[model samples]
Target chain A: MNILEIKDLHVSVGGEQILKGLNLSVEQGSVHAIMGPNGSGKSTLANVLAGKPGYVIDRGEIHFDGDLLNDVDPEVRARAGLFLAFQYPVEIPGVSNMEFLKAAVDSLAAARGGEQTTAVEFVKSVRKIATALDLNPEFLKRGVNEGFSGGERKRNEILQLLLLNPRLAVLDETDSGLDIDAMQTVADGINRFRDAHNCVLLITHYQRLLNHVVPDVVHVLSDGVIVKSGEKDLAVTLEERGYAWLTD
Target chain B: MADRLEDSFAESLIANLDSSSGSWLAVEEIIDRLKSSLTPAATKESWKYTPLRDFLVGFTGAAAVTPDITGVNQPGLTMSALSAAGEYARGPAALANTGPLPLADAALLCAGDAVHIKVSGEIAQPLEISYGEGVQVPIVITLEDNASLQLIERNNAVEFCNHSLFVELNRGSRLNHARSALDSNCCDWGLTQVRLLETTDYRLQQYHTGARKRRAETLILLDGRGARAELTGAYVVESNSHLDQQFIVEHRSPDTFSRQTFHGIGAGKGTIVFNGRIHIHPDSPGSDASLVNKNLALHPEATINTKPELEIYTDDVKCAHGATVGQLAEDSIFYLRSRGLSRDDARTLLCRAFLKSCIEGVLAEEVTEALLRNLTGP
Candidate 1:
């Protein structure tokens, strides 16, 4: 069964159409990669799926776990087991990363009729994740993404995904700012979070990430719609051909 | 209302005066100054932004009535007294009062008498003071020679009250004063004067919330060489309240430095005013000072008036001032809301962040918590 389905999705910003009649679907326990060049609506698709404001949805029907997803808020979508690892996470000065993550986790848990985690319990869980991501305990004390290196920020995003344990994770260019070692670490984290009940939509422009955590399906998005869909080989083909054949 | 208030004020003033007392002489001097230098129609540049006329009209009277202090809450410091006792012991005794200042209009002849704090050496203890309601109570704090102390003062009253604080800092001393006003019923007016000896340093952080009418004025004299002063203030005014802060820092000696930053958030029909002035004498070479005023109008009818002035006489000195008034950043709000916080929650979060710098400077944790609770409303 499809866990998420987007049909005829069209989006616009400031009267400029971006996504036009995009169609895609993903089943549970699968990893999907959407590869496209810059301004090919890859990031726009991620943002629109996450329900970010200011994007005019002219024609679309998005179903997440069999429920209409367009009208819900980004936060509500998060509570409903959807997570977005932003391409460029914002730095919130004076708000510690630990405090923010705990609040987000507690808010989601509360919505799911689960008891809020105690600080001690949260610290224990966070320490484990931080260790896995090669993050120091001191990093949690610092303000959210403030003064953090680009690699550290990407690791922090994975840390949130690990702690929140959402059913569907949409990563927008998570590997964009990572070094080779950091890229391996991020891929490792993605692989660790994969399970039969969960899915991931990895949005990227490079095929380097696909080499590590191979995608179950690769889709090419151009001009707001998915022009081609195939297994992992398509990414290599696009990487080698460089969209020259596809345009022709 | 003005005539009745003036008449009542005169009667109360007379009732509090002891014709033969030496302490009463200061009261007379203040009154004389008010009459001559600060008249009902006085055009003091500092009072231009505020409706001084309306505040004076409501001044009504200054009475000597003993107030009830049983329910007055004391401001708590971030550090524990036991942990800070050694530091506290060596601090300026006159500035170390840990409890709330005696309520204005309270009988301060006995236990409530002003404590003299003399800072003579280096001390790390942070002192906190809270104020309660009523008409006439005086706190006299004196800082002396090469002394250093961090003092946090909080004014939180549940009912109408009037309070006055008189402070003097002498030569080479360092004083960090932090104050917070968090109650709605408080109609408070505070005047602080600091005199710096050679190379003395002073910093002030003031914050207020939920006041009917509140005004705070700070006057600093950089009398000795190398004296420096820094002032930072923020306020969140709601309802129909009016809040104003006026500051004057005079560079009387060469090599003096001073800077001021004031911010405010006005909602509902509330009004806020910030007037900051820096004066550098003709002979005060190597003097540097600047003032910045920023405000956020959270409502259409809310008003904010900011005037930052610099009077520089020495060509060698650097001085500048700037002011900005606008609403909260829309992108910040959207960012928070995107994180799952409701719009109201997002606004509160950003507001808290805006005021956090001032609140954190307050070394006392309990006082900070109380102020945050009050400003954020429950």
Candidate 2:
């Protein structure tokens, strides 16, 4: 079963075309990595899948977990097991991390007709996940991403992904700005969440993260469309040669 | 031009007043001044957006005084109604110089009896006062040096209410006061005055909601060095309700610190207005003051007007003021909703967070919690 299938995906932002006739398909349980240079509409694809506003869909069809979404709100898409780890996680001051996570988890589970976890069990599980991700347990008491360092923000996003267990996780540059140990911890989390019933769409620039969370398939995006596709070696080759050769 | 009907409408309130009505001379003085100023909402340099005329119209001519006082008298507390015998043991000194507004003066002129709170030692339990429907009374609180008190005053099911509260904190004294007015179809008006002596600490948080027109104005004076004050407020209105508040925080001594934060939410065709002013008097060097006012217009027809004014006369002082009148942050809302929460739940969470930011600095956790529950539904 395909968890996500995008057909002729054409997206525009702020009166400009960003994703022009892009196509992609992620089979259930497979990890797909889309690598691109700056301005290649990589982030645009992630945002469009997450159902952000202001991005006009010129023409496209997105089927998530076998459900076609032509007019689904962002929250609806999220409850449908769609998750996007933002490139820059938004900072919501005055909302404790614990409160936000609890609401989020509850919404996701309730939408899927799953039983809710008690507050105590939720805290214990979240604490274990935070510790494994090298995140401070005390951070749960603080405001969401308020005054956190860049690395800390990235780790916090991973913490959400680990706990949510979404069917499709679109991580936009989740490994950026992280030290070596932190990157390894995040990669381990991604690896643990991978299974035959879920999918991962990893959008990134550097190949450093692909080492730990090696993708099953790699695609190079340029000018809003895929220009190259290959195995894991494609990322290593692109890493060494860079996008200059393909563009010229 | 001031309308004679409006001026006379205010005049009618002073006629046949309750025990709150003090000396005839003071009452006459207040009435005479209304002919010109008429309690603001004019083209005056300050107070332009608030149309006091609409509010004063809720004044049903005569003040309604509800003299019901319940609850046990704790060891460190004293309670009274406006007309009970010997209530005059406390004079009008607590209510003096606290009012220049016609409504405030009019409310004072109707003062029948007063509830006085005198604290000379530390009190851990909170003191609550509920003035029944249309209760007109002045609350006087005096704290001796090295003492502290927590108080909550509530006005329920009232119309044309004029309650006065005065607090004086001596050296090293701390006082936390919370006032709320939430009666539908009522016009509630309140006046609060505070004097902070040397090393005295003062904090006040108010939540006003549900009235056809509700207004509370507070005047605080930082009178000695090392004095500190933090005032937080929230106004919630829906379905044609109106909430207005004006605050004046005066820094009179060096090393004094004061902060003010006010948040308002208007859901229907309601109107919310707040004017906060922080005055750094001359020679009050090393004083630090800041004021922030924000309002959320949940409905397109809802009106929100927020202003933060700073009058700095000392060059060595630090002062900052800011105000914003708009809807909730679209980005925050989107972020929350995108995380799987329903749209309504998303808005509730964001709105609660916005309100918490206003009063989180206060030391009264229980008071702040109760206020949050009142402002934002369960």
| Candidate 1 residue lDDT tens string, A1-248 | 78899999999988999999999999999999999988889988888887888887898899999999989887788888888888888787767777777777877888789999999999999999999999898888888788999999899989988998988899999999799999999999999998999999999989999999899999999888888999999999999998657666
User: For all candidates, what are the clash counts?
Assistant: 13, 13
Give a tens-digit lDDT track for model 2, residues A133-174: 888899999999999998889888888988988889999999
The local distance difference test score of each candidate is 0.70, 0.77
Q: Estimate each model's TM-score.
A: 0.82, 0.88
B1-378 per-residue lDDT for model 2 (tens digits): 566556476546666453544433344554565555463334344345455565555455454454444332656555544333122222322222223355544454556344556677788777776766553556667788988877767776555565666677989999988766766568766767788999999988887774677777788889899999998877677766777787888898999999888887776777777878888888999999998888887778988777788788998998988898788777787888879988788877877787777654333364454544544443
Clashes of 2: 13
